[model samples]
Target: MTGPTTIGAAPYDALLLFSFGGPDEHDDVMPFLRNVTAGKGIPDSRLAQVAEHYEHVGGRSPINGQNLALMAALRAELSRRGVELPIIWGNRNWAPYTRDALIELRDRGATRVLALVTSAYSSYSGCRQYREDLALTAGSLEEELGHDLGLRFDKVRSYFNHPGFVAGNTDAVVEAYEQLRARGADLANAPLVFVTHSIPDTMEDASGAARPSYRTQHLDIAAVVAEQAGQRLGVDLTWSLAFCSRSGPPSQPWLEPDVNDGLRELAAGGTTAVVLAPIGFVSDHMEVVYDLDTEAMETARELGLTAVRAGTVGTRPVFVEGLIDLVLERAAVERGESPARAVVGRLGPVADACLPGCCRQRAGVDSGVPALCGQD
Candidate 1:
């Protein structure tokens, strides 16, 4: 375990790498799915179906390992930046859960900690749910331990439009296009498809009120990457946003058109190939691996169109450096220092803290619980 350094410009002494956890083996798949879909009333049959997706990838999701790698990377980056802080990790699901991590932080004498959630958008599932996890875990800890623990957790600002994130996606898109061209794809006819996880329409409608919401965030990032990648390829590229990994009751509506459907439509429109850029996600999780790489790729094959999937900002050098920048920026703000806020897209600068009702949960959920960070 790397020891803490002088990263406490804001009185914060620790960093938490919070993420959505995944199962590590076939035997753990059902239990992992149950953990994920808990309180959703999803049927066992449905969970079994979902388990197949994890099973397809060896009954495990790569996100936990990725988070571990990211934790190490951020530690190294923070150390290199001279902000000596102990960084720990916790997940919303699976082992090393948020409560456990908080216990470790509490034992380490960390009173104030900055959290870096894996998701970078403002939506119920992406942003708000993470806040909920932190709050719930903290409440549980206090209740179970019968002590305040003096823990204060503040989340970093959303980085959907950060230059490092945008640059990484742009580079990945350019690389995907290059690979497609090498595979006899005619760049002139290949349309860019930007894909993201589809939330319910109501959830999308209610995402950040004072700032760009979830759907809008994804769209903005897509536009930025598409424009920059187009400039790199020296061509005016046409692009559209598509949704994937939709799960709900048959009657309930989610975002559309699905990626497979988009591919089919592109094929019908006489498009020979498409470059898929999943700018909506920060890393390659099960959604990207199975939904895009396996399912959508299969659809493209059936439609006789060549498809190439771009990478996410998974430990990219620029992205890692950007995380450090964000941490320092928050610390500066905490210390009453004026730091130039960093943003790469046009819809920003988003607030380092969220306003009340920003990214509100869908109706029927409690919104009054004090968010540990980023809500004014």
Candidate 2:
């Protein structure tokens, strides 16, 4: 593994907590939809149809509020631990945008900042797109605001293998298992299925990691969770990776063994119950609520399989503490100090930040760079 760079003498002036924003009310739904699907030839009528999903959920996604709460929790935790860096929030598609956050930071005399993205894996949308967003935001600030903002933004690495993340997710799965057991389901006979968002196959193949492994990371975490839970409960567990929220055209191949199809297979095999452990996502977003809970639940009902989806790793104490650990480790490394390795025991080494050229975006024709944040 490449050793982390020495921690810089200069401390980070601000910590930018970046995330994908959501609408809070009914009227905000259409505009949010447009923001998410600005390009890709999706018609306004189709967008309106899609808006119904948000409308059904009261035209608000709990993600924004949840993130706000998380920010508060993280700040309090950091302050309690004596890490006095100021934490601010920015959304990629809504109210407090990257640009707005940068302006605030600059106005507050922040010269260097650390960005902690909510995404965990390596993909065009997960990694490269965020960098593009930062670059674009910086350029726009220079052009529109007429301010030469000399800001340096560094992103934290993926924490899939961190002890806190693993522990938090493990707890979530075990909680789900207990709930199933309480429902009179036979946990001993049920299958443990891990679910995540399905990205295009081409993107997966192009991902640049130390071992060119994306699925392995998720699978590793699930296996560890299953083993630990199994030992504690004295139940045999089998785990499989299932995909969800595939949105591209039918012809464009995405991840395989979709969650709905997996449910049918499990039912066909006479599996009595199944637990969906979402190790791929950090929060319960539209995909988790509408796609998995709503659509996948319907499929599970049709197939006669009792499916239970676990909670996400959002703002849990362990999760927030893990973020603090990551920040401290990165900061120490930036200071030229060797940060001690903290293992999850089950999951492997956690990455501190993505390396250059990792998760490259697919090339665009005339624009040169892959489109970021849905081209206008």
Candidate 3:
């Protein structure tokens, strides 16, 4: 662990809340879609077709508002704890951009800033893009502000193993179990299916310091939750991973067995009921709402299998505390102090920033962020 800086930390320091922004209105949908799919060669027609998914939900994604609510909750939590960090929200493809937030932090005399991105896994979009955003935004600030504003930025590490995260997700699954019981549903032999957004298999295979275990990580969380739920409720629960919200071309292989296919199999195999725990995501984004709630639910109904979807661990008090713990844990390491809490032992380097070889950006498309601060 590195020692804490002797220089007094700034009083007006900011904690930038970064997220993958969503379209709030109908008209913003196409443009927001473009930003998200930049460099993918996805034509507007394809995006327009996909826009129908958003249109189904009134052309507004719950992500932006959910992120705002999380930010507010985090601010309140920090304030109550007397942490005194000013938090500002920014989106990658919507209002309150990285450059704008950097200027705001600068205007508020925040020389040192901490960034907390909504993503919790290793990948280009999840980890590297935010750093790229910061670098680009900071460089732009140097030109716009007419001064070299040296900004020191640090981010929190993935919190998949945090106790609060585990506890919150476990509680969500347990609550869903209770709800099923209330509705006269038998969960004694329920199939526990854990779902996550399906990224390209190549991407998943290449993530992290070692080989990425994106699929395995989610499964690990699901196993813990399933064990606890089964132990408490005295039920036999078998868990498996399913992919959802896959939009790339058919040739570009993504993670599988698709949720719908999984449901079909479970139903054919004499599985009476299923409880889907979204361990791969942090919030109830469009993927969770439309993909799981709408599409998966319809499929399960058609198959005559009772399906119950668990909610995400979004802005739960324990989840917020988990975020705080992640930050403090990283800060402790940076300050050369041993973390008070024990993290799950996994194969990976111990740095908040992604490694140079981690999450290689696609060719012909600027990653919009450099791999590391000093490397590029």
Candidate 4:
């Protein structure tokens, strides 16, 4: 720590790296699935089937280690930016839970802690659910600790459109393009297929009353990234957005053009090579490693289409710098100062606090849950 860790971190004593947790081992798989689906009424039979995804990946998800690396990167970034703040981590499940991280922050004598969630979009699972968990943990700890800890929580605004994030994804796609070209793939007319996790139709409608919905945000980022990467490669690149990891039942419709389906369509339509960019994910989590790398790549292989999966913004310097910038921006807002928020495409910077009815079950249906880090 070359400089004091508290330089530009006023109005915020610490930064919390909030994320979704994963299984630590084979035995922890079913239990972790239970933790993830605690209230979903998912049976062990179904969960065990889903647990195969975890088991396939060496019985542990890459999320936990990626998160730790991100925390370390954020710490270094804060110090480099002349802002030092302790970076504490917490998860929605598994070890070192959110409540535990809160305790650590409280023990550090922190009053106001800013959370930088791993998810960068605005949706139920990605955004509001985390806020809901934070509220639940804070409320529970409030009762247990009795005394006034003066601790409060605020989260940085969604950075799906942040310049650094878009640039990172853009660079990743370009790298993937190079990878395919190196593999004897004809890239003179390859389409850039952007892939992301699909959300339910209801959730898509529920996401964007105030800000960009889940689908819309991805589309926005995908368009910008495609153009940027195309210009970099000097190729007249055409691109389309596709989805993966849709866990919904067949009766219910989630986002369409599944990456596999899209790849087959492309191959049938005479598009032989593609660069698959997982723009929606911020790290090489299960969704990226398994869904895109393993499953989608297999589909491309079967179709005889040359393809390569792009990296996520995991610990990338630009993305890390953008997160630190978001922290400082939020701190400025807390101090009643308006700071410039940098974004790439159409959507501007979102509000620091979530508004009422934002990311609800429906346009007008709020969960009636007492969520923190928002005006509502």
Best by TM-score: 4
Give the Cα error of residue 100 in candidate 3, in Å: 1.8
Look at candidate 4 and tell me the lDDT of residue 332: 88
**Candidate 4, 1-376: lDDT as tens digits:** 4646574778888889999988778888898889988987878999888888886689899998999899889888877777768899999988789989988998899988999888888988888889899988888888887865577889999999998899888889889988987887767688889888998888888898777788998888888998888889887679899999888578988988899999999999998888888888999988888898888989999998878788998988988888888889899888889888888888787788987777876777867787888878
Go through the candidates in order and give the clash count of each. 4, 11, 4, 1
Highest-scoring model, lDDT: 4
TM-score of 1: 0.96
CA-only RMSD, every prediction? 2.2, 5.0, 4.0, 1.4
In order, candidate lDDTs are 0.85, 0.78, 0.76, 0.86
> Best to worst by lDDT, what's the order?
4, 1, 2, 3
Encode model 2's per-residue lDDT on 177-281: one tens digit a residue: 998999889998888888888888766765644334567667777778788878877887888899987876899899888988998989998997889888888
Identify the runs in model 2 with alpha carbons over 4 angstroms from their true place. Answer: 1-10, 209-211, 344-353, 363-376
Which 10-residue span in candidate 3 carries the lowest summed lDDT?
3-12
Query: What are the runs in model 4 whose C-alpha is more than 4 Å off?
Result: 147-149
Stretches > 4 Å off in candidate 1: 1-9, 363-370
The regions of model 3 sitting more than 4 angstroms off are: 1-12, 144-146, 208-211, 345-350, 361-369, 372-376
lDDT (Cα, tens digit) per residue for candidate 1, span 133-240: 888889988999898979987888988888888888898999999998799877878999999999898788778556776878888878888888889888878999
- As for model 4, its CA RMSD to the true structure in angstroms is 1.4
Ten contiguous residues with the weakest lDDT in model 1: 1-10
Cα TM-score per model: 0.96, 0.90, 0.90, 0.97
